[model samples]
Each structure stands twice: as C-alpha cells, then as structure tokens.
Target: MPRLVLEARRIALTVQHGLHGRRRAGSGENFWQYRRFIDGEPANRVDWRRSARDDHLYVREREWEAAHTVWIWPDLSPSMDYASRGQAPKRERALIIAFALAELLVKGGERVGMPEMMRPSANRRIAERMAESVVLAPRLPASLPPPFAPSPLSEIVLLGDFWSPASEVAERIELLAASGAQGHLVQIVDPAEETFPFSGRIEFREPESGDRLTVGRAESWRADYDLKLVEHRARIRAAAERLGWSFTVHRTDRPASELLLALHMRMGAGGTASAAPKGGGRAFVSRGPA
Candidate 1:
C-alpha cells in the first residue's frame, strides 16, 4: 500500500512549547528548592489552597513551562530497505513513522528534533528540507553516537533495526532514562530477519556489512539462525525493561499508522490509553517507560 507524506517543518513549530502546540503545564511558578514550608515564608508559596484542607507543610515547586523537545532518529541503514510485504521500503516506512509522530506531537504542541539524520525542530522549513533529503538521497550518518549529551532533558524517538552487535540501541535508551526524559524505540524489521524462511544453496548478504555466506540444504542451519535471532531480540527487550524505555516492534506486514497510534497512546498521547492516570489531583507524567 501507499503512504502519505506530510510536511515536517509545520510540526516543529507547533509543539515547541508543549501541550498541542500551546502551553498546558500547570504553573509558571518559580521553582525553589524543596523546602518544608517555613512558618514565615510567603503565604502564596505555601500552597495554602491545598493547606487548610490537608494540614501538611507543602512546598510549591516553580516549574518553567519550557518547550518540550522530541528527538527522532530514523535508521537509514540498508537493512531498512527491506519490504517483503508491501510497496513502501522499510527505510521509507521509518521516515513515515517519524513524520507521523512529529505531526501528532506537534499537534499537541511538543517540539521535535532529529540528531544526525535531520535537524532540530519540526517546522515548515525543516520539513521541506527533510523532504528534499528524501529525494536527493545522501548516505546516512557514519555511525550513531550516544543519543543524549549533557543537554537539557527532552523526549527521544528512535527508529531503527537495532541490529548492531554492540547493542548501542540499548545503551542509548539507558542514557535517556538516566537523564529523566521519555524514550520510544521503534524497530522496523523485515519478515525474513526472524524466520530464516529460505532454502536451497542461496547466497545471503549482510545488510550492514557486505559479508556473504552460502547455505545449502546440507548446512541449512535454520535452527541456529532462529536461535540467534531470538536471543538478539530478547537482549534488546531485557535492556529496554532495565532502562524503563518504551519499545515497539513493527514488521513491514503492519500498517505504519496503526503502529504509530499504539506508540502515541503509550507515550501519553491520544485517547486509546490515558497517560497513566493522574495521581491525586496533579497529573504525574512518568519519565520512564510506561
């Protein structure tokens, strides 16, 4: 099937502040360090509105409604070009996923940034530039770096095959978790990667590396292939769980939009699933995986 391409730049401009392209965070109060409400501090900071009712010395945290930034990285590795089931290549599918998410997040007023593949912010100009990149087609980044740096904490969206032996995929998620930002991993896979559903003395080519191997009936090695595949996926999942990062697996068989809907809901977007229910009266957004 075919997919629709949306302008990337429009989305970036919208979510820069958060909350559907507008400000929704509770207060612009100045956040002072957590202190027991001293008897003589300003009554306004006492959170007295909640005081007489609860009779607890509650200190108010001044939160700046700074913009919410979402970093999206799409894997352009050759492996992503696999698409056994449909017309869209896995690489294009990855881009579609990134664009759709940026659209939704921008609709919610959340800013979006891409590390090396694309620039920061999902605005009209950036989107147009990204579209141009898609058409002209340059080589991908030589390699991925740890996704997060010593920068302000923000959300991250990773689109990739997660095939590197180093498990750099897992390490990146852990870093993001440590920094107290949300992480979403979208793994785009070709059906063949899992099933080894081939036979005959076929020559196999590695997607990332140009290495080739010929496996014939005498050396089918199907069982071994499946075992390694299972182990690789398991390790990725275990790492995600340990890091508390949200993970989603997408095969070319499924619709990209449907996959996106599930991911967005999990990240506390759309109505399918509400961002883990509010605690007491305050809405608590979980920084780690849900």
Candidate 2:
C-alpha cells in the first residue's frame, strides 16, 4: 500500500479548518456570554441583533481574545542525546514534539516563538519552518533566564530533558508565572533515563561533548541513579506548583500528538480537542505534593 505523505502545512490546515474551527487559538473578541441590558451598561454594549431576535433587551459580555505568544524552548544540552528505547535520540524526540505543538499553536493562529535556541514570533510560518528542523546552539547559554529579545514572554513551553539543576527552572517559572502569563513546562524524557534499564559495565559518554566515563557495574548504580532522577523530577513538579504553572511530563515513546494533547488539556489550549493526557503511561513518578 502506498503511504500517505505527511507535511507540516497539511497538519496546520487540518487544525485550522477542521473540527476545531471556532475554538481555534487566536487573538480577537470571542463570544463569552450575554445578560439583560442594564441602565449603567454602555450603549454599545447592547447586542441589538440578539435583543431583536429574542424580542427582549440583551447585553453582550465578550471575552476579548488575546494572542497567545507561545515559547517552545528546548534544552539542547548533550545529556539529551540518549536514545536507548527508540531509533531517535531523546533530543530528536523532544524536537519532534515541540514542532508538532508549534504547528498546532500556530495553526490556531497563536503567535509561536522558539526564542534563541531558535526564534520567537506570532507567525505560524516561523514555527512550521522549524518543524522537522535541527536545534542549533553553539554552547549552553549561561544558566540565567534567557533574554527574550524585543520583549517579554506571555506564554512559555519549556521542552527538554531539563537535566539542569531544578533550582534554575524553578526561578524561571516563578518569573514567568508572576508575569501573569500562563506557563506550561513540558518535560520530555526518555524511558531509559527514568528507568536506567542498562545492565553490565559500559562506558558512558556525553552525547553532545563526548566526555566518557567507564563504569564497572552499570547495573549496581541503578538504585542510586533512579533515586536522583526521582528527586530531580520531584523538585521540578514542586517548583511548577509553587509558580502556578501547568507541569506535564511526556515520554519520547509516546506520539508527539498525544503530548501536545496532554499540554492542551492543562492550558485549556483550545476546546473539546483539549482533553486529558493520552496513553496514560507513567512518564514521571512525581513524589511529594505538587
């Protein structure tokens, strides 16, 4: 059987004009609700057409639409190169998911940005252009808040292994949330990373830098490694809760579409298409209160 050709443009068209038309993400006045016209209400506030149709006085209450500036930041650290379970590395999986999300957000007409690690903008093309592209970073930027050029952030979606110290992300999230913008911290992880399913002695090498360390008993180190992984994930979850942002964990094994749906559920990104995380797999075993 011939395979169907898949493209970003096709995907965007489906999202923009398909079943998600009215609920598509974009900036404009959206219908909220209506109430009876009141004395103090502005003259223009009265929805005359509706009032005439209903044979009664009515006032329109609209929820002004605000453009969603989506920042899909992916951590390009060497640690993200691990790919034990699948053909693509963890980094590749992260990029694919990011692109799929960018497609959906931009298709809905949200201004999508992939700042420095790439670029940030409200243009769907910028995001679509990045779909299936490579992430290019000369070196890790200083572990400080990335300077969002030309302006500040209204929405942020951090996608990566997030191996950096949890404190850094916590601080960033606080700053982002305090800005009154909805933040979604999407942690892209690999199965091998969480489970440390490796056995026997092997030389571990940094995926980006190529630094290597030969461990005598990789299996014996599993307990300690798993403990630290859990701790790290816990800290991120706690920090997200503190900052009032939605936190989601996506495993590379799952389809990127599912991860996008997972995040949409938390942010109410759109309408009914926005549902709970799919697959229901254990991506992260978060501990403590979050």
Q: Each candidate's TM vs. the true structure?
A: 0.66, 0.66
Residue lDDT tens for model 1, 20-107: 3332534554343344688787877776565666657776665334546777777766666665544457677777777767766655
Candidate lDDT values, in order: 0.56, 0.57
**On a 0 to 1 TM-score scale, where does candidate 1 land against the true structure?**
0.66
lDDT of 2 by residue, 8-100 (tens): 334334444433522332235655567888898678868888999897789776543464477777665566666664446666665655666
Q: Worst ten-residue run, lDDT, model 2?
A: 281-290
- lDDT, model 1: 0.56
RMSD of each: 11.8, 7.4
lDDT of 2 at 67: 48
Separate clash counts for every candidate: 16, 2
- The number of clashing residue pairs in model 2 is 2
